[model samples]
Target chain A: MDEVKIIEIKKSVFADNVKDADALRAELKEKKVFLLNLMSSPGSGKTTTLIQLINRIKDKTRISVMEADIDSDVDAVKIKESTGVSSIQLHTGGMCHLDAEMTRQGLDNLDLEETDLVILENVGNLVCPAEFDTGATCNAMILSVPEGDDKPLKYPLMFTVCDLVIINKMDVVPYFDFDLERCKKYIHLRNPQAQIIPISAKTGFGLDHLADWLLKQLP
Target chain B: MHELGIVFYIIRDVKKVAEENRVERVSEVVMDIGEVSTVVPHLLTHCWRWAADKEELLKGSELKCNIIPAVTWCDDCKQEYETVKHGKTCPHCHSENTWLLRGNEVEIRELVVSG
Candidate 1:
């Protein structure tokens, strides 16, 4: 009989995933497509904002969207109808966040060679989406005014991870008494480099600035 | 909430290592989780217990988590400081102009098995 030795292996499996994400990001950069992972809580107007951006920049750039949800292509359908751009729906089947693998798969489903902008509308949640890197060039977050000004402190990860923060639902600010200055201050406290954009997706207010910012990100 | 999906990654990695080393059963799995990684340790442990038990190699395995503190590098102060608790400002410069250096990671560090 031969004696066997069981040795423990110390390794990081996610290291490979990170490498893959990095490769995908390089490929996106080479293609000159600015990819943005848009994350926010449910009913924060991420879909509406996407629709507005699509309508605004449709003439200037070739836009494609990947919608990630627990279940439902409802938003994708709406985006397709409103924007008339190439869009795909990714059903995570209950996953709270969109991982790099899912984003890669979503990219495969679209023609990235021609896409000037690829926006990944991540699952409607503040926390998990911040943890998963989807190989996006930038992580954009939408924080509605109705969600309160303390959101940056309470959910610091979501706000801090974002390259840009859009304070949506400003049209309803008067009704909810949402302080725009306080929201900006809270976001700056977490991430000072984050660009804050206040807009109303309903009335298309302040969207021109958002459109210009999006265009500037493209190579 | 997505801890279950992460548990699958852990199990897959453990199984791959066990097979490569010709181990019959895995006894312990050690993981280093970052403080600001957005994964609740309790929820992850709960999900790991259920997910790992389903695999023969991981049955009865002890899952140990080492929590890493969040550290950030301040460009203005040119120093690194620990971000104690959540949403704590920089200690030295009191500057919010800081970037994360570490403690946002979630990875499997080591695994122990028996033949």
Candidate 2:
């Protein structure tokens, strides 16, 4: 019988990804490209909000967009047509999220030398995307009013990881039971330092604040 | 679906370890999965079967998960309690000032190989 040996190898599965993410961040810093990872649930108006914000900031800074989905070119086309910015679509091949390596591949396809900011719209998932770092300079997510204010409590990890939480659909606040103050409190419960910006993507309300926030994040 | 991505990471790490040690084939890979790590053990194994079989070193290898029970620590009471049962609140003192001490790990503990 062949001899059996048990090798001790205690390591977290996220360890390599973290290292990769750090390396990617360092490279992006050297290239002077600001990568922003935008996450949220499906139908949270991520595309609409991005279009509005990109259009607002495009004249000030050179911006590009990378849209990741299970399978689709609709978002990339929409972003390019609306904002007149270079956009690419990444297919995750049924994966729920894009990790550091996948994000690097997406970046490699773009002309980063001419780009000041790259907005990566991650796959619409509040769970898996929070687990993998995509080497972005900063992390942001959108929480719409219809999704309820209790989202921060339910998805604690998502709330904790995000640096900014854009509360969208504020125009419909009169019709819904969404409490802005309570929602801010819940978000702060998960992450105290997180900046919250309430916006109505449909009416383009408070988009200037979001655009200014993006501008300040540029390297 | 999330487990499948995890399986790919496991394969990459295991392959690197096997290469460094000059080991040709891995027989069993043991993991330390936490109760609240958000990874389903059975789903990990199910995904492992599909991904591991595709790798030469990991083919026919078994993936074993050792579940670590989640425990939460209370700041006010300074007591420990089962996290799954009490959640963010301390059951003993009923204080909401609590945090998880462990049970959020998703680690590769060991690898068994035939020499």
Candidate 3:
């Protein structure tokens, strides 16, 4: 029996992603631009929350947004048309998540040197987005009231990696069976350091707090 | 959902390694997929099959995924527990000082090649 040679090549599939993310983060830091990676499930009010937050702070801050979607450019159009901020749409060509290199490509063309903040509205996915660091200074996730409280339990990685958890659609919380305290407890369990903010993009409730937090993060 | 994109990454990385090692044809690419990791094993395999066949170096190459169970380390109890079962809080001591030790790997463990 001719023995086949088995060569060992231990390489991380995501190692290149980690390196690119670190480099982009260093570059962003050097340029004095704060990058925020915002992630959530589709219909989690990520766009609405971003629109409201953009309207609130785009005046005082030199900020722009990058909308990432699997196919559609509708979100990017909405951000530009409604908020009037410089926006770019990144179509993943069929991919659901945005990795570091994808984000870097978006930032490279968007002109972030003069911008104070660059928000990556990562592809609407709670599971895959958290897996790759998109070279953002802070990672934020939106969990709407209608989405129920068990999301943190089901998608622990998204909650765990997030620095801030925004509970959107607070106006509809009374209608839904979502227990706010219980949801907060679940988020805290996975991520004790995560700061949870209850907000309503429809009613314009916590956009001020979210905007203020964004300003504070600018270094 | 984006397993196809992940497939592209695997192909790119595998090709780079093969080129560096001066290998002509790659037979197999083994991956260490974590249980709780975002990349689904089956979907990744499907994507790899479709994409690898197109590449000259990776033609008919097999993509093997080894599942790794997620485990969390409890700081208070100094013990390891299953992450999927107990979630974040340590069931042994109910401590919040627990962190994930492993099972989040999305790396290529080894590559099988032939001259």
- The lDDT leader among the candidates is 2
Candidate 2 chain B minimal-lDDT segment of 10 residues: B88-97
Where model 2 places Cα greater than 4 Å from the true spot, the runs are: B92-97
Q: For residues A103-213, could you state the per-residue lDDT of candidate 2 as single tens digits?
A: 999999999889999999999999999999999999999999999999998889899999999999999999988999999989987888999999998998999999998
> If the candidates were sorted by their DockQ against the true structure, best first, what order would they fall in?
2, 3, 1
| lDDT ranking, high to low | 2, 3, 1
Per-residue lDDT of candidate 2, residues B1-115 (tens digit): 4899999899999999999998988999999999999899999999999999998888899999999999999999899999998787788999877889999999999999975
- Stretches of candidate 3 above 4 Å error? A1-4
TM-score between model 2 and native: 0.95
> Which candidate, 2 or 3, would have the higher TM-score against the true structure?
2
* Number of the candidate with higher DockQ, 1 or 2: 2
| Cα TM-score per model | 0.88, 0.95, 0.94
Position B40, candidate 3: lDDT: 90
Q: Which candidate is the best by TM-score?
A: 2
TM-score of chain B of each: 0.90, 0.97, 0.95
Positional deviation of residue A23's Cα in model 1 after best superposition, in angstroms: 0.7
What DockQ does predicted model 1 obtain?
Answer: 0.48
lDDT: worst 10-residue window of model 2 chain A: A210-219
What C-alpha lDDT, on a 0 to 100 scale, does residue A212 get in candidate 1?
A: 97
Comparing 1 and 2 by TM-score, which wins?
Answer: 2
lDDT over C-alpha atoms for residue A118 of model 2: 93
